[model samples]
Target: MKKIIEGKIWTAVCVALTLLMIVSAIWIGMRYYVSMDIYQTPSMFLEGEYSVDGGEWKSIEKDRYITDHFHKIVFKGKMSKKLLMYFGSLTISSKNVWYTLKTSDGTVIQSYNFDDEKLSYEHTQTDKPLALDMPNTPGYCVKTIYPDYLTKTENITEDSDLIFEVEYPYSYALVSYNDCVDVTAYYNEGMYLRFFYDALPPVLLFVLICFFGLFFFPVASFILGKIDYKYLTFGMLSFLWGLYMIMQQISGYLNLWIVDPTVCMMMDKITGYCFVAAVLFYFKANMSSRGTRIAANIASAAYLSCVFTVFILHLCHIRDLNASSMTMNFATAGSIVIMIVLLCVEMRINRNALFFLLSWVPLLLTVAIDAVDQFIHLPGSHYFNYGLAITMIVQIVRLIGDLRLQYKEAIRHQQMQKELYEAKVSVMTSQIRPHFMYNALTSIAMMCEIDPKIAKEATITFAKYLRGNMDSLKQTGPVPFTQELEHLKKYLYIEKLRFDDLLNIEYDIQATDFVLPLLSVQPLVENAVKHGVGMKEDGGTVRISTRETETAYEVVIEDDGVGFDINEQKDDGRSHVGMENTKKRLHDMCGGEVKIESVVGKGTTVIVILPKEGQPNEDTLS
Candidate 1:
């Protein structure tokens, strides 16, 4: 059970099941509450006729731009019995106007208004579209109140003509009247409930993404104590994008609960601008090339400058913020182009760039499609929200992959460090054997009275040899061959004092400018003196030599004493751990190798080979 809990496959299965449950729940809710009988017809306004200020009547278009809000608009249309039977209510929704419903002969029905006073328009056609001053409250937002029991209304007949007297009296609003209007026909109460329910899942997904971006990632980074700027910027990108997407999905319903509708509009605008800036910041943070980072920085600065300029102009009453929509669109499009180009260039060199491109391109394309749909007043499908969900999933997967790589690398680094430390400890202990120390010190003490001059020399050499063994413990890597040779000579000098003429020493020097693991060669020389020569009655010569090959530098230690069979394992209760550690270190540190050749009653030979710079070790190559 513990192993299953710890396994990655189990975690993946849990996540998949959780996601499936969430999706199934949403689907069940949607299928249960939403009515299939709900349908839409072409807006009734398309068949009506409108007269501006009692002037000539013109056929109403699918969409109308009303530039002359100072005049009254009288819209005339007829209600059919079939239309009234199917739809329980009709909503004439708009942010720019308030209207009264009346019969064609001019009998009043109902009036929708927050205040009775006429609105004052401060500017005319001379200035850009202006934001008029209005009460900063939810009451100021236009509310739709369709008549109850419309099919049974007393004033209505099967072919009764209705008149809509519209006025923009609260403000000098100049905009596409159709942009904010929705002439939706509700069949039943279920339609209203379904309208909000349809948006619930997308809103929930975006909110979850926002929570992770604004709180989870940043807090995790802080706790880890490694401040990765890329994750920070990614979090910012996620937050702004998520907020923007959420607003796009449900900002209309949000107005009903907010203090000020205009504040929501401003927040929406700011989120859009900041979302673009976040993308550039995330790109800059992730870039490895200085040129790419600089490019992203400059692009971000330019985009921010445009956003600030638009806001400044809006605040100064030079222009309304909505009037600069074209400029904002161009800026957003330009940033998209730049990002696509950068990603294309980076994809050739960076593997992660492909993932980034995959995540971003679909979002860009879906947003463009949704933007076009909104601009044309098409029914909302909001494919961009799906794109956002995909982007979030991809980014999460990418982060997990990076973390896995980091974990593996950290484990590998620790393992290598452990092996290196153990190698150093093994070589140190082998060099400072208690028996060799006792014999050398005993020889020195006996010689102190027999020959004081020789005794003093041997004492200093012994001290130096002991110092070398201690120093080897501190070394983490290979040392120069000359340094190892000097340390080895100190050990040999002390050994000669103990084993007088019985132990012979020889040196064949040809190469001295190479490096090997610290104390590497000295251990083999000690093995020769102790195991090969000292066991014989007539102690023989232990020869140390170095020579340069075409591709390597070699150190050879040979002893002309009783040599044991190379294939035979000695069972003298002795562990040859030092030999194994030396071989391991040689291969790990410098790709070097060790070879031994011995025959019973003959001499033994040990060779160490280290590759030359820029040359592959022959042992590794084979």
Candidate 2:
């Protein structure tokens, strides 16, 4: 269970599942807001007459089913004066007046001219075409309620010639004058809700995700990651696309002053192409395959050429949007499908990146649904710009996923650095221990000349001391508690030879099976004898004890000797490197801890705590 829990494959799966849960939660929350109320349409519609010309009310084209691109139809019949009329495109008055309501004899009853931050206009001759106030935002946004709905009193005669023009080739084009205006309002609300969520919040969310506080995080990430990121490109794309969608949703009132739907479609096409191009750039920026790069570059150039060509034709007053739209949809859809396939292939080869590619699944679905909707024309299916907003969200998720991988990589790098440090410290302590070994050997050599029997016994003990130190160096993993204790005992026996009766040792060994880093306890014992005991004329006792507790195993090395002040800004010029190295290795290798306490001229105690279980998961480095 422990192995499975900590395994790499399971860790990745856990992360993916966690992210999916969070995304699902958020999606449910958004669905709640997008469906604040169930808006239902009334069961009836208003009916009115259409005429091709003022003289022929029953002419062949009098039914005036004009729709789609540049359409001019005349509605010159009477209806309920207690009526509500709205245009989804820019409108004109034959009298060179801004929108006006006249009685039967042509006496204007009410007139309105719009020009403000949200709307503006230019009345030339008898044409009333208006532009929006937002910069680089080419469109019309005029929404005016002729008279408050509350002002409706009695029925009277009404007549007007309404012309309609839009960008997207209409799937259904029919002049609709619903006699039941109340039903139209409720019907539109239901339709709009069904199509999409509120555009304002989604747009704002994408903006924040892209910039993350004035582009601080995105800019820093770009520099640190060294990739030609497309966050800004996608952000602009969503911004324009969102505006275009919002205009369509509030068309009757919001954009009645704007010149036709041409502006809306133009904006959509331009940004859509730009968005597709940015995707190509993102692929090139992060890709390694030269062939893929060449292909994406060619595709991007082709898309740019087509978009620019269509834009030039539109600018020159040649307004046909169908051909360009068809081309754009096919090209964009094909490119996205190819990209998705490539990501899937990459994921198969590198399962470590499975979660990373999973982040693009939402974007791929959006592309596929839009492709089928545009090309197949399924009557039973109608998709809105919700996918457009969701695509931006997926990109944000991708960014977050990339950052997560980077964070993990950073943590791995840090672990490697720590291991290297531990090796370096081990080598340092090994060097210092050899100096102590030489001193002990020297003492034995002198004893050999004076007392040959003592020297022989000392030589046998020296072999054990040397063997213990070499064993510690050979095995990087911790040894059993008893094994380490034996090494310490061998070390103390060698030191006792030089100090004879001056060195006294005591043991209160209780722990039996807990594992600890090699040589972790020996150095503390060596320090007690060398620094604490050797400082006094009357040598002291070095007491070593170990106890097993519920959580951890505690080991204490105490010495009754002339101890130095721990906080005194003074040293014995020895550096005390071995004691420090032992403390660090114990804690880092085994989830252990070390603490030291001392009183001047009294005694010193060094306590070590080792976790009483399986080896420490080294990732939890202290």
Candidate 3:
């Protein structure tokens, strides 16, 4: 047990280290190729005066910016000469707000207008394009101050007071920067290439993880059997979480599609809610205690209900999704806290719970940081993305260890079953050999007194029949039907010498193209002649026949002799070893079965049915 645990841990560490090294190598390569030598500086309007709702102007403080809904705030600042000397273009970047750039003479140079009549909330309308100069990433807008555009179009010069009117529905932060290149020049300088490298690697990693979780892991779990449910639930959680991460980077960095900000925002929130619910479901599936599972169930349902309510609110224009984000985060955090407490309880009994704690703790911290970041407006923070990578890596490593253990267990179980089956077959062969030898030798002794020539032939046949039965002791599996039939013919040839005219044998063979257990059918025929026919004063005939059916091949042994009740218990209390052993070996070797139909006054019929599925079809009887 100690060695197994050590091996699992070693494997997990190696895999985790390899994954980290791959990511690090890709990042280093990207950094080497994408140069960060771009010319840029902070704007002169870093300190500005602002007015809220057309009220009196107040001086702006560091890291303190205007934030409100459906309110107009104007910022007034002067463009410096140093910015003009460098032909420096001013860039203003903000999210979830609509504003226009204007000169001191109140001439609007560029406008990104949001129709206030369309929405009761502060979000820009998603029904149509917000404006001509829309950013590819949702909620992100950039306005560049081009040197040529200012002088040619607006005829503005250095130290000009720039009047900015802004209305914020949702605001992150409004920041200004002076750069050497204009908006066109910035894109031409391969800004997209830098963002692609920054975002695509993690997306590719998460996608691969999703493929394993959704497909590979579940297949492994099915083969393992006992741990199937938990693997499926965890797989669902991983897939949904990976999808959420992919969607986060889709429009922002990859820019695969030009999507509305509101649409992207909703998608981000929806996938987040789904994966969180999946997390709760995963806990429920993994929990050993019934009480913990019930608790997890309730938590998952409530979380999904909260998400539904938030969506309803957004759809009805009662409340926006952004307004409910913090509330939802708290709900998610509460579920995580309860799950952690449950994991603590489980860790007391199960060592695997310790591994779960290790994976989840970093995620809990990430969720806490994200809640705080949402409130404080942290710029370009991907704490959740980083934390998710760590958690997924740990969980995947643990899963690989689990699957490896299961494969070993399955192989061990199969070997044990095979050994047990062989032991049973050996015991069955031993039982038939002694009983048949006694009967054949007794018949041969009786025939020697009657005729020397006939007795000599019977002796040779008896010797061959005994040889066949002895050979079966060494046999492991099924033999061709023809082989067993030849042995049966030799047994009957000896029996015919003893019974003479009293015993009559008939054969009606239709099909002889399949395999069955060695020594399986012969015993049934022996019982029919000895017990069924020889019991009467003048013995009756025994007919042996073989035929094919749609689903199986059958050998029938029918005797027109006095039969006994099949349902009655024998007086001796000793079982018929030949019949019972033949039944077992037939079923075990070829998925075949025996059906006995006997009437006390009439006769008996024993049918051996071998299903065609597993039986070999070869070596047709000559």
Q: Model 3 clash pairs?
A: none
Q: Mind sharing the TM-score for model 2?
A: 0.42
| Candidate number of the best TM-score | 1
What is each predicted model's overall lDDT from 0 to 1?
0.69, 0.54, 0.67
Candidate 1, 28-98: lDDT as tens digits: 78879766557442345324787776788877655344333333677787665555666665645444356
Q: Candidate 3: where are CA atoms >4 Å away? A: 1-28, 37-94, 104-107, 111-147, 163-191, 223-227, 251-256, 344-351, 369-384, 434-622
Candidate 3 residues 1-622, lDDT tens each?
A: 4355446546644664576578768878877876653434232242467676777887755443333222466768755554554544555443445666677788876555564232212233354542322232224344455666777677766767777776655443322211111121232323344346556777776675576568666765665545588788877877887788886655342212333445545666788888888888887776787777787777888888999999888666576676677788789888877887887787767777777777777776886796676457555456787788788777777777777787677766566456535644554464356766676678777767877787798888777776776776677767788898998898788777668788999999898888887777777887888888988789989999999999999999999889989999878664576566667668766888999999996889999999999775454432
TM-scores of the models, in the given order?
0.62, 0.42, 0.55
Off by over 4 Å in 1: 1-27, 30-142, 146-179, 182-196, 212-232, 315-317, 347-359, 364-392, 411-622
Candidate 1 steric clashes:
0
Question: Could you tell me which residue pairs clash in candidate 2?
Answer: 46-178, 46-179, 46-180, 47-179, 81-156, 140-258, 143-253
lDDT of 2 at 27: 56
Give the Å shift of residue 219 in candidate 3: 3.3
Give every collision pair in model 1. Answer: none
Instruction: Report how far off residue 320 is in candidate 2 (Å).
Output: 6.4
